[model samples]
Target chain A: MRAVAALCLVIGLAVPALGWAQEDKPAEFPEKLEIGISTDEIAISSDFRGADLTIFGAIEGYDPSLLAQSKYDIVVALEGPKDNNTVRVKERIFGIWVNRRSMTFELVPESYSLSSTRDVETIAAPPVLNGVGVGIQHIRLSPVGYLGDGSNLTEFRDAFRRLKESGGFYQRDPGGVQFISASLFKATVKLPANVPNGTHVVRAHLFRDGVFIAEKALPLRVMKTGIEQMISNAAYNQSFAYGAFSVMLAVLTGWLASVVFRKD
Target chain B: MNIFIILGMGAAVGFLSGMFGVGGGFLITPLLIFYNIPPVVAVATGANQVVASSISGALSHFRRGTLDVKLGTVLLVGGLAGATVGIWIFSLLRSLGQLDLVISLLYVVLLGTVGTLMLLESIRALRRAAANQPVSLRRPGQHNWVHRLPLKMRFKKSKIYLSVIPVVGLGFGIGILTSIMGVGGGFIMVPAMIYLLRIPTNVVVGTSLFQIIFVTAYTTVVQATTNYSVDIVLAFILMVAGVIGAQYGVRVGQKLRGEQLRALLALLVLAVGARLAVDLVVTPEDIYSIVSEGVYR
Candidate 1:
């Protein structure tokens, strides 16, 4: 009797899966979403080192019956301010290194932190990710003014990505996003100490069967505050005054040291 | 970089600065390069730190009334002009992606030449001492090509009468080196003053420190404003530790005689130069590298 009941359960599970497979119909996306950052504004002080950015959110409107069926995979990416960048490749030319080729990429973010529940390749097809611009590799690279073959240009683009990735600007963690419950997910992104101060965009994407069904985005501000803020502002905005101040401070320090450590 | 690393490097460099009377940029720059700080940032920040130490040393001399203010002023003028031009060239090299190569080559040449000369001179002095031969500290000033220039001036403090053109030219040359190499130019400045200008040893130290003050300050300001590469926090950390390290280094310097000290400093200088030279001759692990224009944002 137990065996018969087990068979019935198996058939019951397979039938619905088969029916859904045969349906060949598109699935509904998330009905609603809610998201937030650990802090709306990040204030970097003089002693600022680095911080972890916790991005958490909850999804809604998924079938209640399939709650335990691994319903969705989430990807959260924090894209810092975007700007144009030039990537140069150096070649060893007769005992010296020189830049031989160069390419410019528009729409490159100053910093990018990406997190996903699974490896991005497993999350979706390359075409799908490329179309949606899901990963660092998927970042749009439209060379503005360059004279190079398409294949060679791609190498330069790859080199840019590689270099940035090593520099802590471009980051990704496959298992960074954790599913807390049936509908809630969270991710932790590392904010580097040298993170550029600006308005950053945080995006949370939900995927099912390698298809992007829904996503949400929020703005987070990384800024300098307190005396550090004033100094940083002066350094860039009122650069001359800042430079003069730095020089003066050095001189004063030197003067003080001389007085303190004078040989009697 | 880790705080510990910065602190450690600062301390090590400071000790050297105090002992050898070098600006420590010679030591600091190569170490920073090893730690992977961008060469541009290293050079700019190195100048920023050097300004502080030079000021401290210069002030002590000023108090002793050993510093030649008149001579310092003249050098300062030439330094200012040279610093501006050097900064212009630095920017040009940065754009061409040749800044690192140029700076490294400069280090190799400067360190190699200076270290070898110091080593030979110190060894000769050591032999004279061991052979029980009387060692004359200073040779009488002799007429040289430098004396033929125009604008003659008498520096009572240094007790020398020389052409202002050569003084200005020397200062200008050192200033150009300061901006590019991020040093106070003390290592070269002292030697130039003693050997070329034939300045008295007592006046040379104070005067070199005096001139270093203005040149490095100008370099720091220009680098901060034009390049925006000066990391004030990094500079402060280096300065504080450097100042302290210099104190300890002073104590160590007192124990070593002049010949031994110069010989050791020369060996250290040559070692660093050799390491840099090897990097050029040997194939790099990765020939391809990337650099972003402007502050990396």
Candidate 2:
């Protein structure tokens, strides 16, 4: 009887030890993502062309096992400040092209860039990606008092994406994100010179086995610097003063040129 | 944006501006648009550049003692009123997504008519000169309906005692075209002063430019306040090149006769007009256009 008791006690201790190990799995993969940009602010001056932003990040407690099944899928997306943006499709009417029907998507990004480790389709299911707003299709395009029975909604949305994409406002670079190590990753986002001046949001998402594991957001600012800033503020804020200034400057320049060049 | 291309284009525009005593906006706008600059920005910024160029020409005229300030003031009143309407039309068409179409149509018509008229008139003058036929200044000595109009005023410098109604009407008409074309209306204004208002050619350029400064200034303010489409940087760049080009143009223009100069200017205008016409008639590469609020600025 004593021998049997000893075996029972040993077995009980081993089972809990194994159970505790299983419970520690969540702790191993911390649900935290930390990201930082190479620069906090991008200044657009007179000669502003497109610029590149380096985003480096470290994932908390990344497991090698996640890669055994498939390479870790990391998607980084940049969204401009939310505003009501209109999208229209042109149809040939009477041998001339004119805008037909239109749709407005509230909270649309002026510019969107997407980068992933592999093809987005290979990383996760459509529902999972869409739910988490990972792909272009997943973007929340809340219609602003949309007309019709929402039957042709997809058509308008697709046109919006197509237009933005053509203008370099929207981009999809599958190879944009590269992993340096198991727990570290980096991405480079190229901003066109015409990128709107405003606050932009950058999101980093991690997925494993078609399941979202972690997500984080980092805010970025795109702004005009030096004279560009001054002029922009004058026009938008003190509009009357700015207008007066422009006229005064033009008149002064004209008069000055005449005075300087007048011969006899 | 290729800086070299912009500078080169600026120099060419500046030369033409200085030679013809024009603002060069008509030429600059199309090139800028071709280089992928947004149309609104192109138009507004072109206006800003015109103000500077016109002011220079006007100041020279003022120094030469050819400018008629009294007549200019009358035109200024009409121009300001017309500019307000022009800006409103610019914005209305923009929202309707038809500004590009309207701007093109206006350019084709204005340039075509003016260019053809100038060309034919210059050819006639050249033939008269070649035949050694003394060119007589044509004037109507008899009183006509134009003189019968109300609010008659004396423009001593232009040597015409005419009603302010026609002068103001002419100003108002040119003002509308100025805003739409992003020009100082020099091409139209000079001829209008000579033929329509019967102002002497000696002082017409100065008077027209004087009025243009005010007209474009008003346009600049309105566009800046309402549309916020002007790019100061772009304007500054173009201005630098324009100033230099104008200097060279003045030197070259000194060697040409009036008819020869008019014929060349007519040809240049016709070329630009024809290019715009082709774009309108030809099917575009992409029927669908994409613009956003951000690009509007």
Candidate 3:
């Protein structure tokens, strides 16, 4: 009788499991994150000043109890294209300040702007943030060569972060992310006036109860337009032609000036 | 960054260059550095500006039958070779993070020496004028150690048979300066041609200008291709303003006594050198800095 009862219970559970599998529905705890940008491309002109970029996102399959308790947190970051960055520290040598030591960080973002619901440190543990590499302070900055004794690693990293922050290439807005509704959020990140042109990425991370749950990323292209950009492009892409043209222009200008100002 | 400021700066430097018979590249590069433009950009763009400034002077000399084409061509050959070597050194220093320091140090030495010499010469000239003494000219026929060198070349335009070795050497040295310091090197080249090589004073300015146009033009092209530091817009604005200002400056210069103009120019050069020296000795605002590797794109 006990075996029959056990068999009946197993079949009952199997039927619901089969039904759930057929419906292709995930468990309630598996919340999903989705983000959208109004435009995937940003056009920068000669007169471009720093401006704000807004990103909209929604959380799917969120728990009602967790939402009521304000357990959900969102952090969105817009990271510029990555390149090798070198940081140098100057020391006094022979009454002159000179660059004495330099460390190059491999594959780091040229520019980074972060927006979060609250202070990133308060929202999650330091280890969690570091693991996710979400915050500017938490981003990975691995040095490009051998580091002896691992000493001065922190010093160089701190200096690099400080310089980038001071130069306005790296920025953060702790309160820039806000929840318009229970499941939707809006985040605003800054685009510096000197923002690099390349394929940037807009990354959105959702954390629940101090635990990271869902993350989404979308590519954003930053393009420079107008004559300035055209000139820059020519300089890099068709450098030889551009160089010849510059020489020609200078020659013409000089010849014209002499002709016009001839006293003979 | 400000167009008006740049235009004004260009005009002021142009006025001084016109008055002193200079290319103005030295003044432009340092002034740009002070205005917060990167030293690399300033150096490259200054070379471009020199090309424009020199072309007109060279052209005028050509029409006046003062320029020595054969000598200028020989100098150009050496200048091109030297520029290639200079660009290599520029890239090396840049990668080592010492390019700015080296540039500043070189300017300090060049400007300091040139300024002091000019001041001393001008003071002597003023004293002589005050005493109603006759102006003494150096004998052109006097032989120097430079004449002993082999591979002599006849430059009929200057009416002198000179060693190609010294001419090419001088051109090479000036070429290096043109690439690294962003100066047409006329200030040094003119004096060297007059005193060292004993070239005829009548043709020295024209020949130097001819060589300067080609050397600076070559430097501009190479800098654009290798460093991508030549700013065309900045160069154009500076050229336009500079040419306009040079016209007025020539008229004003004609009204001034030679010694007085030299004294004023000496003071200006000394002031710029002193400023650079102070920046080097004094404590900087920040010691830590960062450079992003790769192109902006």
Model 1, residue A104: distance off in Å is: 3.3
What is the per-residue lDDT of model 2 for residues B42-97, given as tens digits with 9 covering 90 to 100? 88888888887777777767887899999899988888788888888899988777
- What lDDT score goes with residue B230 in model 3? 88
lDDT pick, better of 2 and 3: 3
Error of 2 at B170 (Å): 2.3
CAPRI quality band, candidate 3: medium
> Order of candidates by lDDT, top first?
3, 1, 2
Question: TM-score order of candidates, best first?
Answer: 3, 2, 1
DockQ metric, candidate 3: 0.59
lDDT value, residue A258 of candidate 2: 68
Pairs clashing within candidate 3 = none
lDDT of 1 by residue, B103-132 (tens): 999999989998999999999999999998
DockQ for every model, please.
0.37, 0.35, 0.59
Arrange candidates, best DockQ first: 3, 1, 2
TM-score of each: 0.79, 0.81, 0.93
User: Which candidate wins on TM-score?
Assistant: 3
Model 2 chain B poorest ten-residue lDDT run? B288-297
lDDT tens per residue, model 1, A1-264:
000000001111222223322233245553344566545676677566766677767766666665567757788888887777777676777876656667777767888888988888888889988876878988777787766668787787788888889888889989998877667777877676667778888877777777776666778787766676676677778777777777887887777787788888
